[model samples]
Target: MSGESAKGQKSYTNALLRLENITKAFGNTKVLNGVSLTVGAGEFLTLLGSSGCGKTTTLRIIAGLERPDSGRVFLEERDITYSEPNKRDVNTVFQNYALFPHMNVESNVGYSLRIRSVNKVEIKQRVADALRLTRMDEYAKRMPTELSGGQMQRVAIARAIINRPKLLLLDEPLGALDLQLRRRMQIELKRLQRELGIAFIYITHDQEEALNMSDRIAVIRGGLLEQTGGAAEIYDAPRTSYVARFVGSANILRGVSALSSLLPNEIIAVRGENIVMEPYSEQSRGLKGVVTDKRFAGGMLRISARLNQSGAEVVSSRHGIDSPLTPGQSVSVSWDAASEIVVKDNDTGEVS
Candidate 1:
């Protein structure tokens, strides 16, 4: 399970790749449990989850870096679960820009081509084409040490793409960069994937990255697939309590459903955000609470209010809102029932 395979080439499959019920374990720890997903041709799918949640294990399974204990994988409908890493039409770009310091940029990119016994002319052509696509053509003769983190990472990407793999696996490809560079690379990676027309299975713990880049997101929790949906679907209608708090800045509140409110309690979660906080309107049907804290972030004012019954504090940030009072101020907090996301834990039966 922990060994390297010799570099070799195989006939390229026309289909991208598909993973079905892939499960993996290490020692006594179960990493991936019954994970099933598909990466269509020319698509970008992201595996988003927190640390130790099996995102990385799933990526490794796709890359042929780790063999699943059960399930199967297919490229173009051809079974390849036992296929060698180099034989599969896939490549992975590690988080730590895996570039060779001794090798120049061109060598790094063309290394796989060399292993495949590609002719010198074809290798040179592919190296030039890949480098040009990543905007690193001029640095062909430069060594890995000669480039910055972002630049070297581009070299890593160029190296992966040069192989002309049908599927590209990116494990936090932009994780090493600073915030600004990471944002820039996110745009760059998306654009590059579009231009390549190849399937991308991206893995990351960052939800924002998943929202921004993925055509579809597969959320994993506790080694299980929680939910898979588009950005709007998962953010707006989270299937579980864990999902709502994980995807965005969620403000979970407690409220007993008033049946005659002209709206379903299910839709109450959406109405909580639009609740008017200005001078507490009398028409608002909300829990009375004390405002415990306030934070001014840029153009938005965040208010943390504690409910009277359970003393559970719900946070709401109002845009272009400035409060007239200080912290620990006494205020009757109210929110339209329509704006709240009514989440109930199945085990505890407590509304989140």
Candidate 2:
């Protein structure tokens, strides 16, 4: 999809949550600096950023776990900034499963309803429904210790959704699982969000996770929102160098005088897969470079080349099992002009 249409998808008539000028500081360190955002009802929005970028703090503020030093939080137009966590209609699932070892899966999932004095019949029905939604009905009698990490995560999600909150906050909930399991859980989580039809505010530093599952992605940097758009919009047209590099792998070409199309201050970012590398020939029209390294990455081969004129390293990916190019082999690198992305350099230098 084009960036324009991707951005247009964020215009919502019914906003479920709104954060206005939220700011929080811990002693001399300011964690959130006037961060503002909105979550639409039944939308899946992800807070994407590296560690210490205030994404987690933003999630906590919305959950009422951490009150903002300044600004207001509104849930369905109701002011809930100073409300207690339990008082608000929001639930959180942390990275650690944090399941009760003494309780079985059914008891853990139904604990919230039980504490509220819900009748046994209603509680049991709700618990059963939650387990079935999370595909953990078969494991209801199992304890936390007997279940795997993925199962424990499912239980945590089930517990969070048992009360049917208006919004759910997930703080890197898939960080504990292995690669294969994490990928599978990503699909499962998206499906669960769709089935529940509730707003989900997910936190993650992994760009792939954000791109795969989020309806919209908000990229945070230096305690500020750098960019917010759909996955394709963020990947195709990043507004700044920090965002371009953070969202995906890009060949950032800076100070390349050879490209006359770019302004003096602007830099170019090309995706590895968009770049084409071929063996050098006398009739070659692209930049001459030598292959510096090559490696096999599952389904694709990644080749790194160093330009002879500018001495800048470039990486290109091709779909194949092996490449004939070897280290020190002469090659030419080129890409379509439409593939080049011109982005502004980050002046703050606060992005990690």
Candidate 3:
């Protein structure tokens, strides 16, 4: 399900957008601190982070909705750090569809061109093309109030793309949809991006969404970029404990000297799926632990255990519904040495 390798090959020699040492703050609280990133032409890059982590702020800055207190923004090699939103070659699709309730889909999609006094015939033709690209051509006659959430979202996308901007910024555009609809939209959005061959800077807090749709993900934390890489790279080799635990469910093992040597501020991060758990015995070859909890999660069994020596809680996953693990059972928790990822404690500096 990862497009890391194929998407990673997209060239950045002709970068579409670049932010240099961007910094922003409101009143006394700094929201963004020295962030810099680039979006290659036609590449799908996702800015991922939890709410208020500055992902949205970064997006707004790119879209010209917010200005960075410091740093420069360039699009197609032209500095646009202070350019008016209307002058920038950028378009945005927000979580809310923002479609006019009084307008039909066709009118909404053509509004930007119409407002600019584009020829009527050209607006009509372009609107149709945009709607068809989004697979919503047949619904052009429908009013915004009459469309389903997904349909409305499609219309919003059509509207945003009708002008054919070089870079499209989507600010959690699918967040309002139901789970099933959201998943379907993810695929549709990626397909549309490829077909358009335009760069997309998508914003989302959903790690799964980022992994499934992004060529590269920029993990943001505390107003700064924590790490940025393809889906597989970020997942398999996170640079810090915060990224390891934030991007997915990682069990942070602290003070576990048996696994590897660590400083007082360092820790180990082992993914649940990478751990191997077995019934504990005198001859067991790993840390002894007692199962503290077990649950059947559809196709896999999730087991949580507490290591007897370090009192560290570890989670492991086993395929199938037949796992016989019980809460009170003793088990040996071990993982391949290669699977042990020694990461820096985010609060402290990087581990040497």
Residues 127-205, model 1: lDDT tens digits = 9999999999999999999999999999999999887687889999888889899999999998888777777889888
Stretches of candidate 2 off by over 4 Å are: 1-11, 258-260, 347-352
Number of colliding residue pairs in each model: 9, 0, 0
In the range 4-39, model 2's lDDT, one tens digit per residue, is 122333456677899999999999899999998988
TM-score against truth, every candidate: 0.85, 0.91, 0.92
Q: Judged by lDDT relative to the true structure, which candidate is superior, 1 or 2?
A: 2
Model 3: per-residue Cα lDDT at residue 146: 90
Give the Å error, residue 257, model 3.
1.6
The CA lDDT of each predicted structure is 0.75, 0.87, 0.87
Better of 1 and 3 by TM-score: 3
Best by TM-score: 3
lDDT, residue 205, model 1 = 80
